[model samples]
Target: MMDHTDQTTVLTHAGVMAMLAAAIAEAEATGQPQCIVIVDGSGELLGEVRMTGAKYLSRKSARSKARTAASIGAPTTAIPDAVRAPIGAATGGEMTALPGGLPIKVGGVLLRGIGVGSGSGDQDVAVGLAALRAIRAATEF
Candidate 1:
């Protein structure tokens, strides 16, 4: 291995905007204004949105969900139920067990994470999926 690491792929500003746009559209289509958050694989925030009528506190939860997905490379729901509370407490609630968070994987490379809130879990998941589909068309790892 080299002494230093090689450069890694990152989502561009345009890409993040595309994902956010898609997520917002999905939320509107479902008639649930939502708070959506996206994070890079390193758990750095990229983009976010709080649509009209969305729950104020849901933004925090959405960020937690995005960070959770980025940290774990899986949906927030993947956290084992037995350890969910412990993990949340350990992380100071930085991670979540809700169903809205999903990893943005393309051709097996985890690139980003998205979380949507202020709606039912299913609706949130739907919004996240829409975001993923945006980048899916542009890149596959």
Candidate 2:
């Protein structure tokens, strides 16, 4: 039996909107067309965006970041490639082998969510990070 108390809250629609806007703003500023995704603490989809001219694969890549963050409760980037490489393969067709996903938290309790952008791996990660910053400043949790 799973304990509900241990489960993390999912990001709401409003939360998703905020996250997407921040990521979009950042990606636009960088002049890098990309995709962005925000997931709940539990790794559920909260929000997602694919920029104009972004590659078709950006959507799946963004979702992969969200899943990684939610599942580990940490920035997906923090995980070593060795661990991620296998997990990516283990998931078979579902997992995306890409960078640019992060998990949001507050004091030990997971409240915030993660974001992922589609671009170069580094650029995608940067956009996601910026969204996290925006959420932290604008929301209570």
Candidate 3:
């Protein structure tokens, strides 16, 4: 159902970096300082940035955002925590049911990742989406 080349295209550090930068810029423009995180397919940090005035707890929230996206391989907001119960229980609390995290995908395969926080959940998700959109617009992979 999936191909190895597709997987490779989606997980590159460059791709992840681009997405994170775009997300951070978008968040900064909103006047609500935020923290942005990018992780690899395995949930390892690829990139991270915190904007001015971002709250202290935003760092942890950003991590949770990335974890949620990486675990589910989708936008974190797309799958709320209520729907993550069974999966979270099985994963031993690794999965999250929150906003501001997103998985980078290419050709339907997950590559790098995204996470945003320090503002409202909706703002966080919005910033993450802006990053994804930039990625999608920049290149096919």
lDDT tens per residue, model 1, 105-125: 766678788889999999999
The TM-score, computed over Cα atoms with residue i paired to residue i, of candidate 1 is 0.91
TM, every model: 0.91, 0.79, 0.77
RMSD, candidate 1, Å: 2.1
Score candidate 1 by lDDT.
Answer: 0.89
Ranking by lDDT: 1, 3, 2
For 1-141, candidate 2 gives per-residue lDDT tens digits of 876676544456876787778888888899898877776655666667788888877687777777777676666667777776777888763444466767676546655445465578888888887777776743332
Better of 2 and 3 by TM-score: 2
Minimum summed lDDT over a 10-residue window in model 1 is located at 132-141
Task: State, as a TM-score between 0 and 1, how close model 2 is to the true structure.
Answer: 0.79
Please list all clashing residue pairs in model 1, or write none if there are none: none
Instruction: Per model, state how many residue pairs clash.
Output: 0, 0, 2
lDDT of each: 0.89, 0.69, 0.75
lDDT of 3 by residue, 46-99 (tens): 778888799977877787778778777777667754667776677675666667
**10 residues in a row with least lDDT, candidate 2:** 132-141
